[model samples]
Target: MTVENALAGLAEQGWVAEAEADEAVSRRVGRPARRFRFRAEAGCMLGFDIGLHKVLAIVADLRGQVLGTRRTAVTPALPAEERLAAARRLGHCTLRSAGLTAQDVRGVGVGTTGVVAADGTVTRSDLLPDWTGTDLVTAFTEPFDAPVMAGNDARLAALAEHWRGAAAGTEDVLYIHVGRRISSGLLIGGKVHTGRHGAAGELGVLPSSRWDTAPGRLLAHWADPQTLFAAAGAGEAKALAALEDFADDLAQGVAAMTLTLDPELVAVGGGLSRAGRLITDPLSRRLAELCLFPVPVAASQLGDEAVALGGIRLALNAVERELFDVNG
Candidate 1:
C-alpha cells in the first residue's frame, strides 16, 4: 500500500486521529468514524540522517525505544540521485537487520543539514552538494509506501535536545549547532518555531564584521562563528580573536532572540560544541552581558546523535499521534 493508504489503514484499524502535539489543540473535530475492533499492535518509526560523509538510520518502536541503527560512508563523487538510491537501499537493510520490513515501518523521518523548503525540498546541503532542491518526501514515500517527514538537521537536533535530551523540561530553549558552519534552532512554548520561509535558524547568513564581502563566499564562511571557536581550540591566536568577536556577535543574536522570545535555556551541539569551555564559557558571559534575563547555557546531552534522535521522536509521535509539543 502507498503511504496514504497506510495511514488510512491505520485509521481503519481504529487508531484515533490526534492533533500534532507540536501544534495547538483545536476544539473542532473531523467526522467520527465507526469504531473498528482491532487489538493494538507493536510498530516502529525510522529516523534517518543523510550527511556529507555517511548516512545514519535509527529504528525505534512506538514508545521511542531504539531497536537498531545502521551507518555507512558515502562516496561523495556520485550524483544526487545515485546517493538517494543508495540511501533507500541502506534504509531497507537497516530495517532488515532489525528484523522488520518496509511495510512494517509506520513512518520515516529524515534530518539533513542546510536550507529545507516548506514543501519538503532540501536546498543547499553542505554535505551533499548535489542534493540541492532534492525532494526527499517523494524519494522515500513512493517506494516504501510509508509516510515520510523531513527537516533541517540542526532544527531537529534542537527539537530532540528539548524533547528527550539535555534541554528536557524547558518551555523555551535555544540550540546552537556548531560545525563547519553555525546554525541555531528554537523551541518556544515547547514547539519548534521555524520562521516563515523555513529559514529562521540559518545563522550562517547572519551578518558579522569578521567576514569579507570582496570575494562574497569569504563572508559566508567567516560569518559562521563556529569556525572561529574551532580555530581557537586549534590554538590559533587570530582565530581566537575572531572567535571572541564572534562571541560578542553571538551575544547580540542571542540577546535579540531572548528579548523577543525569552527562552528559558540555550544548549550548544554538533562537532564543534565538543570544545566545551572554549566556546560555552565565553558565550555564557557574553549572554549575561547582553541580556536582561539570566538563563543558563549548557551542552547537548546526545552529542552528534541529537538530530537523528529528534527524527525518531518526530516519527514516533506522528505515528502514535501522541503529544509532542513539550520539550520533555
Candidate 2:
C-alpha cells in the first residue's frame, strides 16, 4: 500500500503514467493488471563533461534516458570564456535536439579536468592554464536556473561506471582515467569519496606517479600511442615490450591506492581504455605482482561518454533528493 501510494504521488507529479493494460498475462483469474510506465519527459537533466580537448553535453529524462547529446573537440589552450561558450553551444544543441528548453531542466551537473572545490570552483588545473579558479557553478547558474553541481572529470567517470558501466553493484571502486594525463577517482562504500579539498584520488599531482614523464618514457622509442596500441593489438613485439614498461609505471601508482583502499575492482577509463587486452592484460599482470593481494582490473566500455553520462547521473541524484524519498 505504501508503494502504491508512492507511485500514485509520483504519477501526480507526471513522473509516471498508466500504460496499456497487460491482458495477455492475467494473474487474478481473467482480470488483468494495469501497467505503469516512466514518463521520461517529466523533467530534464543537463550534463556536461568539459575536458582539456573536448566538451560533451547531454540531455537526459527523469528516468535517466539520454534524449540528446553533443560533443565537440577543442584545443587545450582555449581560454575559460571561450570554453564556457563552447559548452553553452553544445548545451543548446542537445536541448534543441531533445525538444526541451532550459525551463524543463530540473538540475545541471558539470565535470571538468581539475580539483573542484565544494562550491564548484576549479581550485587547481594542470592542463588548462586559465581553468584554475573558474567559478563553474556561477557560470552555470546564470544560464540555467536549476540546481547546479561540479566535480572532477575522473570522479564523474567513476560515478558513471558505478551507475551503469563496469563497476555497477560494487561498493568500493578505484577508477583510473588514462589519457594524455592520468587521474583517479574512488567510490568508497557505494558513495563517491571526495576528501576535504575534493582531490582525494588525484594521483597525477604526485611526481612519483610518472604520468607527466610518460610522453617519451614508453621505453620502446616508438611514438604515437594510437599507432603503437594498434601495433601492439596486432601483436608487434616492440610495442608489446613498451606497453609492459608503461604498465609497470602505471601499476606503481595503482598498487599504492589498492593497498590503501582495497577496493573490489579497478576500472580503467578515458580514450585509452579502448586498447582492450593490450592495456588491461599488462595492467592486471602488473597489479597482481605489486599489490598486497589480487586486484581485478576492468577496462571501460563506456568510451568517452563516461564522464558526460556521469554528469547526468549526478544531476539526477540531486533531482531525486528534492522530488522523492531516496533513503526510504
Candidate 3:
C-alpha cells in the first residue's frame, strides 16, 4: 500500500490523525509530505503489584513510560474481598492521577506473592489470607474491561530487571528476592523459566533450608530488614552477626541455583535489596566462596517499583500482541 493508503487505514483505526502542515518541505518529497501523527489520546495500560503489606498501581503508556502510581498499605489479615477492593481502589486512583480512566486502559498486569499459573490463577499463596486458587485475570478483567495477565511478584521483578534494570542485556539470570521471604526467578536463554508446577523459585521449600528460618529470626529482633541493616551498618555486633548468618544461608541457595543453571548474572532484588552495600557486599563475598567461579551480583536499581514495572511490561506485551499484532 502507498503512504496515503497507510495513513488512511491508520486514521480509520483511530491510531493516527492528519493535521495541517506548519511548514512546507523541499521538493525531495512530492508536494511535501502531509503531516500525520499518532492520536493524542492513545490508550494506556495498568500494572499492579499486590504485596503482602501493600498494593501498588502503576499507569503507563504503550512505550512503558510510567505516568503515575499509587500505593496503599494492606495487611494480610484483611479478608480477601477487602484486599481486592483496596487493589481496585488503588488501580483506579493511579489511572486518575495519570489523567486516564479505566476505559482508556488496554490491558492490566498484576504481580502478586504466590505461585501464579499460566492462566493467571493463584495456585498457592502463603503470604495472603485466602488468596490461593484465585483467578486474577477474571478479577481485573471485569472491572477494567481490559485483558489481564498475572505472575508471581518475584518472577515479575526479574522481568523488570531484565527489561530496564540491573539485568539488562543479559540472557540468563538468577534473580534472588530476599526480604521477609526467600524466593528466586530464573531467566534462561532470555525467557522466564517457570517450572512445570509454577514453583521453580521457592527456595525456602527446600527441606531444612536455612532460608526458611533465617529471615524470620533476624526480623524477630528488628522491625524490618532495613532496621537490621541499619544496625549492622552502625557496627552493632548482634546485627552484624545476623547479617553474616543470613548471607551464608542466602549464598547456599544461590550456589544450588548456580550449579544447576550457571546463569550469566545474579540480581538481588526485593525490599531488602535497598540495603545496598550492607547486603550486596556480604552476599557477593559469600557467593564467591560457594561457587567455583566468581558470579557478579548487584542490587536491584529499580527498588520497590520493580514488580509494578514488570507488571507494566507484561501488560504492554499483552496489549501489543492483541492490538498491534506484535510479539511481546
TM-score of each: 0.73, 0.90, 0.90
lDDT of 1 by residue, 174-201 (tens): 8877665567788888877777767775
lDDT of 3 by residue, 52-153 (tens): 889999998877888998999988798777888899989999999988889998889999998999999999987774999888998899899989999999
Ranking by lDDT: 2, 3, 1
Q: Count the backbone clashes (under 3 Å) in each candidate.
A: 1, 0, 0
Instruction: Give me the runs in candidate 3 sitting further than 4 Å from their true place.
Output: 2-7, 17-41, 323-328
Best by lDDT: 2
Q: lDDT for model 3, please.
A: 0.85
Weakest lDDT window of 10 consecutive positions for candidate 2: 214-223
Residue 178, model 3: lDDT of 84
Error of 2 at 234 (Å): 1.9
lDDT of model number 1: 0.72
lDDT of each: 0.72, 0.87, 0.85
